[model samples]
Target: MTLLEQLGIKHPFLLAPMAGVSTPELAAEVSNQGGLGSLGLGASTASSAREQILKTQELTDQPFQVNFFCHQPAVLDAQIAQQWIDYLSPQFQKYGATPPEQLNCIYPSFLDNDDFLNVVLETQPKAVSFHFGIPHAHQIQALKAAGILTLVSATNLAEALAIEAAGIDVIIAQGIEAGGHRGIFNETFDSSVRTADLVQLIKKHCQLPIVAAGGIMTGQQAKVLLNLGADALQLGTAFVQCKSSNANIAYRKALFDQPITQITASISGRPARGLINHWHMQIDTPERPQVPAYPYTYDLGKQLHAAAVQHNDHGFGAFWAGSNVAQIRELEAADLINQLVLEMNFA
Candidate 1:
């Protein structure tokens, strides 16, 4: 059977689970249109994640995926975090807000959080996907026992092999062209392979279904990946302009009106692609300090972003996007899905 048949979906499109972007309304619209919609629970608490899942269920009976960050908790150095805050204080001052006295990483680990796991079990989503890394064997066994199909992102052949060996049902082949944080397993972001190359490599090495991602915006691009042996296509930036996305005015306007550039590990200590802005330009200075790791660095980043937003500044926010963001359109989720399906059908 085809991968879509196994997932019980008619279309080969899967919405990328973008934190602060994919809302329940968007997920429902895509699922209701016979495609897989996803809710990103990476930055959310168990209660919020469950609430989003339940809300999506209320809107559609179709199957959808819920994604989590299976990230290990980073050990924060008080000195380093304080240094970051000190460096960012000037930006805060410009906005007339004082930085928090002490910075804290507010994100909890999904691996250790039983509450989040229990909610997943209760919701029994059609698929559960992981970014950053895969779970332990016992955790994988538990999810499989619950009959939840699994998917994970792989940046290289080694990570792809690891996911297949761990018994994940499908692989999301995320290329360097993908926006946001990469899904490399314990590897630096610089090691990520391009999508076109990674998809072809995985097809030769793994039996699991491959879903190509990154830099895919139009029907012609989607057709290129699908024809290259991708069982499905996962798109993030393409859907950012959809009406249901939780993108604020600044973010959506940036997508439509601005040009994006690739930056290497300057903001989040992990390489990410987004629109060029004042924050990135300043951070790129010769005197810029080393960034803290993952969630720890992200905490300080969020504070700066909050301050920026309050002052109507777009420079500090994490406005992530893929290489093909220029092709994005302001359409409703259902209409976008319909157009993609029409393109795929005729291609």
Candidate 2:
């Protein structure tokens, strides 16, 4: 069966499962329009993730995918955590707030435990995709036994080969231009390949279906990747402007006003591309210290953002967007999917 047939969708479009921004309404809208919809469950607890999955099931019977983070669990180094906190404490004080005494691991990795795996089996979405790394052997075995397709993000040929070797159903070729997290399994290294090039590179060596992601804002761009052998296209920044998304007013405004984006590891202890803001201009400096581990550093970043928001400083927010955010349009999910289909055909 073709990728579209496996996904149970008419159009070869998939909504990038943006964690904070994806909503049930948006997912349903896209799926209703014959495009595969998605929910980013990496940030949610198992219970909350199940709730969102059930809610989306009620909203539409059409097929959609749920995503989870698969980063290796890291032990927090207190000294390093304290140093990162110390560096950002001045900014906290500027807002008349003190930073947290200690940072907590706000998000859990799928590899950390079977909590997420159990949730996926229970909720049983059409498919499940992972980022940062691939799932464990037992996790993959259970998912396949349940008859759910598994997908994983691949940033380079090595990661693609690893995913193929592990028996993942599809490979999401996440380019360096991808807006959110870099999805490089090893945080220490990233090949930083672009979308079109990565698609062809992986297609040449890997047998899995390739889903092109990153910096795809228009159907013309989507067509380019498809022509280069991408089995499907997944876009995040384009659908962020939809009404059903959870992006705040400030984030939505910034998407248009400041289309320029930069990648920084300071916010989440992982390199993710987003609109240029304080994180890029002020925090990520030449003299900055090495950040703490993945979710540990994210804890402090959230607190500082909350404190800044009380003072109307939205610049501290995690306003993630792809490199092609400048081409974003303000359209509802259904309308945007329809427009992409139209443009894809004409292109």
Candidate 3:
């Protein structure tokens, strides 16, 4: 069967499940319009994730997917955490605040426990996708038995091979240009493959369907990946501007006014691509110490951002977007999907 057929969607489009930015309305709108809608529940509690899943189901009967972070549970080092806190203390001081002494693990990985797995099985979304790494074997088996499609983001061939070996039904080829967290299974290394190249590489070796993600802001770009052997296209930055998306005023404005993007591990500890701002220009200096770790460094980053916001400095916000954010348009979710279909057909 075709990838779209397996996905139970009419179009070969999937909204990139963007944590913090995804909304039930946005997910439903995409699914209602014939593409796969998605929820980024990596940051949500199982109860909250359930609520979001049920709300999306109420809004649309069409198939949709929900996603969670599959990162290995973060291991915080005291010395490193203290250094990171001390380094950012000055920035906090500028806003008349102080960094917290203990950095909390703000997000729980799907692999850390069975909470997220239970949510997926209970809600039974058409698909469940993961990032940073793959779910445990038992989690994968349970998901497969539940009849929900499984997808995982793979940055390079090794990760792709692992995902395939783990019995994931589909692969999300997250190019280096992707916004948000890079889905490198190993935190310390990234092969840095681009979207088109990654698609070709995976298709040549892996038998599973490929979903091209990252830096895809236009239908022509989506078509290019499709030609390169991607079975479907996933767009995150392209949908962040939708009215239903949870993006704030500052984030929306920056997407249009400042389109340049760069990857930094400063914001969330794990490296993610977002529009260049203070984190890129001021904080990520040559003398910057090694960041503590995922989620822990994110704790400090969030605190500093909160303080900066109080002082009316929105540059500290996490305004994530793909490298091709310059090509972003001002369309709503359904309209954007329609426009993309037209563009893809013509392209």
Q: Model 2: residues >4 Å from true position, as ranges? A: none
Residue 179 displacement (Å), model 2: 0.4
- Global Cα RMSD, each model: 1.5, 0.7, 0.6
| Model 2, span 148-255: residue lDDT tens | 999999999999999999999999999999998999999989999999999999999989999999989888999999999999999999999888999999999999
Q: How close is candidate 2 to the true structure, as a TM-score?
A: 0.99
- List residue ranges in candidate 3 displaced over 4 A: none
- State, as a TM-score between 0 and 1, how close model 3 is to the true structure: 0.99
Q: Of the pair 1 and 2, which is ahead by lDDT?
A: 2
Q: Predict model 2's lDDT versus the native.
A: 0.95
Using all chains and alpha carbons, the TM-scores for the candidates as numbered come to: 0.96, 0.99, 0.99
Clashes of each: 0, 0, 0
Report lDDT per candidate: 0.84, 0.95, 0.94
Please write out the lDDT profile of model 1 over residues 1-347, one tens digit for every residue: 89999788888899999988999999989989998999988889999999999999999999999998877777777787777778888988999989887766766667765777788899898998999888778778878999999999998998899999999999999998898878866735456688999999999999999999999877778888988889999988988888788988888889988857565565665567787777678876778776777777777778888888887887887888988788887788888888887877777
* Model 3: per-residue Cα lDDT at residue 101: 93
Model 3, 281-307: lDDT tens digits are 999999998898898888788888889
